[model samples]
Target: MARPVWSGTLTFGLVSLPVQMFTATDSHTVRFHQLQRGTSDRVRNKRVNERTGEEVPLDEVVKAFDDGDEYVLVEPEELDDIAPGRSRTLEITGFVDLRDVEPIFFDRTYFLGPKGKEYTKVYALLEKALGEAGAAGIATFVMRNHQYLVAVRAEAGLLTLHTLHWADEIRDPRREIDNLPGRTKVTDRELKMARQLVDTLRIDWKPEDFHDTYQERVTALIEAKRTGKSVEKAEPPAESTNVVDLMDALRASVDRAKKPSDQPSGHGGKKRANSGDTSPPTHIRDAAAKRRSGGGGRRKGGGAGSSKGASLDTLTKAELYRRATEASVPGRSSMNRGELVDALRGARQHRATS
Candidate 1:
């Protein structure tokens, strides 16, 4: 069973629906404690007074809210006193087009379902109504002593609640973009090549397709470090990637994006790391080149179809994943490699008809 982090009733108009909130995301960053170089003991964080150098207990900490221009220190109990509702309810004051709400307003998301099995009908009814209208229920629900601008929308077969950020929280892009020049006009040739490049690189966007590449590389690096491997520093890529001629560079980039088999593929390739979590693109290219030279083909005849068949069906799902790593497919760690063989097959068939 899943745990509810917050319990409250969702209220909009006369309808009051009970609900619970749970976290929608998790982090897997490796944690390390500060440790002395020669000792087995771990280091501890301490809060000490700068002047007196006295250690402070955790309970001694207090949050200070900025009141106007001054800092107003308040106690925990005081915050509890101001908790959003004496009677738990989400109040929907108004509704607006989803497009009207800028992306900056979105903060977090949570799944909202009927609080109990008894509210099943109500849940379905709400989900259906929201779906048909193509409208997100703009509502405010109090959770964890604070009120949140939450968008209630039905996804798949369930109610999903997305928490929105307050207007004050969003940084003004114009402030950072100050003094930016107006757009430069492009020639017909430049525009044509640019569009061609974009179309060539375009692919169906599935959130699961990509991953935290830097994280995976970092993890690999850490593992390599633990194994006592050394990493060499690399020279940087060309500083002036801006081309002398726009259309010519775009044409070159498009051709380079293709696979050696003459297939019009995107800018995706394998990479190799020096016993660390991070691998360089150049290293991956080098490895691929070396493999191609040592063995004429990974399959029979060096034909596209035969090579794909060998690559796809040569091994089980795990083997395909290994091959994909050899191919430098992104987000490999987050995948159940064996299951992907069936998935890729289905995806390919679907794409062919569509």
Candidate 2:
């Protein structure tokens, strides 16, 4: 079992349970260290006085609040003295329906566990009650010198705490978004087709059915580079069909969804070929056929003419990136200009032989 990051008492009106909080999630992103080019020296960051150009010691640093014409310096000891005193307690104010809280307000989540063997019974009781009621407790607590408004609920047989954003922190989208679709007319036929398309595509919610292809590709690229193996650029994706008619597009979508597709749905990819879709209008059908016939050929976005012998040294980073995108080069997003050149060249060579 992993050790909890926080240990505190969770309290209601009169009941209190000794609980510990564990992180619910972790990021799987690839990380890199800064280094000087053409050398193995690691890059170092130093805090220095702006005017004197001298490195400053960590102990000498003091946080300051900026005013219009002056700055007010604050000491760590002073902040500690005035910080919220309920650091060891998570006091629940009230219980409310979980659905009443919007998802946008959620920031981070943590798993709440019983601190000791004696608290297990009480913890289970609270979890059961919350699960049955479909409610969560709203509470305020201080952690790491910062106060947070949070919701506590039961999930997956464990009590969970989710930090929520303050009301003033959430911005109204309407203020920034222009030309809102206040009212739009939709014909019965269009609505019916849209619903049919949704129904045809709907399936049981399965979290395991999806995987992060981009991250996988990135990992592959890193491994290949380390092993001194060749990298291949992927073919550019197809352009979506541009239809002016809403009803026609929905119908076509429904027909496309019904057919088996090679592209992964998890990555938002569509069918590569509509093998037997004939329900669409004659023009649409002709366009689909043309797309299928030219599937193996160069796409407009793929930079098709850049073959194996093409010189990548003279190309700009953006052009190299485009070629990498076409070839589905893994971890290409993070590669530097020189790395991209090397990867693109290797990809082209691999494609020529295969």
Candidate 3:
């Protein structure tokens, strides 16, 4: 069992449960020390006085705040003196429906366990009450000199606390997003096909089913190198073509989803980070360049004189998203229709110029 990182009283009304907070998750990323290339010596970091060019002792290091032309040095003891409180307590402010909080606001999570055998009953009672009510308790607490907004809820048989970002910390999409969709319409048949595709591929989430293949490949590479073995290189996936119709792509995706797991869907396998290919694949760039050169063929039953540039502005949200996907626009998944159009147009122009 992991040791508790923090111990505090969880208070609500007249009830106070003495609990210990243990981190619920941990990163498994491999760590490497900085070293000089071709040398066995490891690099080290040091703190020094900027003006004097002298190494500064840890005890002598004081944090300073810039105030225009001068600086105010503050001692570590001064920070402790102005801390929230002497007694550590996570006081519940109010209960709220769990659905009210968006997933984006959540940060780190911790598990709450009874500090002593005597506190188990109260802890279980609180967990059960929150679980039955289908609600989470909003609370504020201080830890490591930082105040955190948190949501406490029941998970499995234990209480879990998720640290949340303050309301002011969340950026307003209206201000940050310039090209938001105005009014876009989707054909009933297209919408139906899209839903069918989603329904066909949907499955219960099993985290264990997915593994970090890149990390595994990296480990294998290191092992092979140590044993004096050369690893074979794998081919990259082909780039997607510019989509002329949304319904056609959705239909093809649905068919692929229905196919057996062993069969390939023409598209390449996911590119692993260990592959060391930083630039976008050649096929994607080529395809984007082709699209930018007015390679979009005439729509079925349409004349060759049809305006391809003007047609882009009249595309549905689904069609715009498909184009954005082909162009590999970052964060395109969350963008609105107009934003997708703007990004796709910019990507096309960039591909053409570059």
Candidate 4:
């Protein structure tokens, strides 16, 4: 095992156990440094003086703060001395039901384990207690010299600690968003149809069922570019679709979800005719074809012309993420789908380049 970055203890009045903190999470993808296109040699970066176009020595550089006009330079070493350090202990302040904590506050997750054989019993006790209570312990711990709020809870037989963002860090939705529908004047028939459609498509979260098709497409694009193959642009869907009478669409969607797709014939992806003139009704064909195109049309917000009725489920996860990147949605920097899903889709499409 590698050496821990910090050594600490979980203190909860009369119960203390030694613990160690290891660097959690890693970049699975390989990293590379920028270099000149023609050469394999490392491209060195020179420290250039901003005012004068000349190289500056590293030792002469100092930290500076700007007041939107002028900069006040301070000795770099002063920053180290002035900045306070976290006390380096996972001090439990209290416990709260895990459900009560909003998803916005969560930042990063880490695992906490007993430091030695002697501390195992106390560690197990804390884990069991938290698990039984269906609660998470709110604790403070120092990692990389900064104090952070962490939620310590038990999962998979180990104590897992999730670092949290401050409450003030989350932006208010009311500020950026305006002119949204209040009650959405949906008809009872439509609501019933929508509910029935949701039921037909319900399935367990089999993660394998989902894959980053965008990433796969991107990989294919990179390979095509490398091999000098023509990267054909996909045809865009028609300019528009109507949004009125969603109930009729919902009714069709329920039937589509319930019906199994026709078996494939030996003819490249063609459906074998169980019955003549049986081209899956127009709506079903459109929905399935959209899936094969990797939902390019949905990402562009043109759902066959229904400008006001774009849906997040209309696109795949990868398409949604691509739109999020293009839209430059806020906090998309750290959002996981379960929380960011439907909300982020519309947000990204409408958000400005802030």
Candidate 5:
């Protein structure tokens, strides 16, 4: 079993329960070591006295605050002494509807479990109540000498705690961002076409259908380099759309989205003939033929390109991303608009030759 990161007593009103919190997620990003350029020697970092130019032991290190001229040093024990009982207790102030809390306030999540078998009944009761009420318990607790605001709620028959950002920490977007589009206007025709495009492209939510394609490519790059092979360079991003041709772009997008099979399978790349699907549907082949025959002309904001042509350059980043997803292009997730177009073009050429 995995070890819990924190163990503490959770109290709400007259009820108290002992619980252990475990990390709910893990990262799979590739890490690289720092090394000297053109040399095999590894680079390392060390704590050293700047004045004396000598390495300092970790035990001798103390927290310090710079008061303009001089540094105020303080021991770790001094900070702990000031924390009081917050380090061991998680007291819930009250329960509130989970939907009321904005998503921006939420941060890290942790799984909560009863500390022992004896406390299972109490844990189950709380979990049931939270689930039925669709509410979360707001609480404040101290861990590792830092305080955090958290929300405790039931998830998949168990309790989960999510760290929340303090109200003052969230920045106002209107104030932070420049050139805000407060009230943009659009024609009814353009709006209708946009709605049609949206309807055509709507899909069921399936998180398993997506993945960290960029990381997968990073791993592949490492393997290829290890084998003395060259990696392919990605294409540049697409140009911004011209608002003058918004309706044409929307119409073209809707036409493309109508053919769901044009999108790539979840397995990445085209489906194999052995999978009992020999080729695309008749309608898809007809549409591709039509596009190839110059029936699909370039518009100001349209990315409508035939599989055999340079029209891919006219497509927006979002359009390119969709096409990349359909073609199962590797590393598409991390790619900019230009990269997506380049990858899609490469995929098309590969399919044609094969």
Candidate 6:
């Protein structure tokens, strides 16, 4: 069982409910240790005094604010003395519609559970009330000497507390960003094409359909190096679209989007066949044979097929990369535009011959 990070009494108006807060998320990122360049010795960091050149214990380290001419030192106990007294209490000052809160303000999340079985009824009642009202309780409390602005709301029959950033903490993008395209005008045709492209690429929001491909590649690279094998390098990013080619680019993108992807939807490729059926079905094998023998009818434009009159040279580098991926071309990632075109041409000729 997981332990609670905090135990406190949540209060709003005259009602008080005892609750325990548990962290709601965990990170699965891979971590690496620092080491010497040519040796296996681990490199570590230590707090040290500049004047004495000696390592200092954590308890002896004090925070110091640099003034123009002097340093103002503060002890850990001094900070504790100035912390708010409501450290063990989460008092909701007011409730507001959940939609009123911007996504940028929300930070970390914690699950709030009843402290004891006897408090379950009160907890459930509050959760139900919040859910029905579509509101979040605004609260402020201190934890580990830091005061946090938080929102408490009902989620899936339980109370969830989300830490929020102070209003001033959010940066004004208009002021901070220098290259924003403010008041840029677009032609009606361009806007229509852009909307068409968006519609063509529309997909349902399914978080499970996505994976950390970069992290997976990193793991693959590590394993490949461990086994004395070479790993494929990631392809270079495509060039930015020129303003003169904006319409053409949008049209091409829309056309590409309309075509079904040759790659798998999620991380991995096609599912493995069952043990009973080790080989592909008869129709699949016949289709493969037809493709290899060039007996299938000529595919239309924008397909990876090397049918008569299909021009691989006219396709963009990104398009060529896609075709290379579908054809399982070797060293496609590190190939340039011309090289990709040549490689695709070679692959097509080889397919036709074999």
Counted clashes in each candidate structure = 9, 4, 0, 5, 4, 0
lDDT of 4 by residue, 1-354 (tens): 867766778888778888877666664443458888999878878999889989998888777889889998877455545443335467888999999999989988777878999889999998899889999989886654366888988887888888898788788887878876767687787778888977765654544334343444456667899899966443234222235425445665675445432322122232211211112234544554555467646535446322234466554333343344434444332333433466574665556553
TM-score per candidate, in order? 0.68, 0.71, 0.70, 0.62, 0.77, 0.74
**Poorest 10 consecutive residues of model 1 by lDDT?**
271-280
Model 2 global lDDT (CA atoms, 0 to 1): 0.73
lDDT of each candidate versus the true structure: 0.61, 0.73, 0.71, 0.62, 0.75, 0.75
How many backbone collisions does model 4 have? 5
Which residue pairs come into collision in candidate 4?
240-304, 240-305, 241-304, 241-305, 241-306
Pairs in clash, predicted candidate 6: none
RMSD of 5: 7.9
For model 1, the stretches where C-alpha displacement exceeds 4 angstroms are: 49-51, 65-71, 231-240, 258-354
lDDT of 1 by residue, 22-105 (tens): 777787776777889999888887898788999978898787888799999988777777766742676666656666777778
Q: Deviation in angstroms for 68 in model 6?
A: 3.5
Candidate 3 C-alpha lDDT tens digits along 1-354: 899988889999989988999999977676779999999899989997899989999988878999999999988767766766543889998999999999989999999999999999999999999999999999988887678899999999899999999999999988999887757677799889989977776654545434654565567677889999986443344345345545545665665445422332222321111122222333234334444666766445443322234567675554455455555565554454557678887988998999
Model 2, 1-354: lDDT tens digits are 888888889999899999999998888888888999999999989999999999999999998899978999999777767756547889999999999999999999999999999999999999999999999999998887788999999898999999999999999888978877768677798789989998776665545444554566678799999999976553343345554445556765676556433333333443221111123243344445545567445435433333334468765454565556556666554565677788877887998999
**Candidate 6 local accuracy as lDDT?**
0.75
Model 4 residue 336 CA deviation (Å) reads 23
Model 4 CA lDDT for position 24: 69
lDDT of 5 at 191: 82
lDDT of 2 at 134: 98
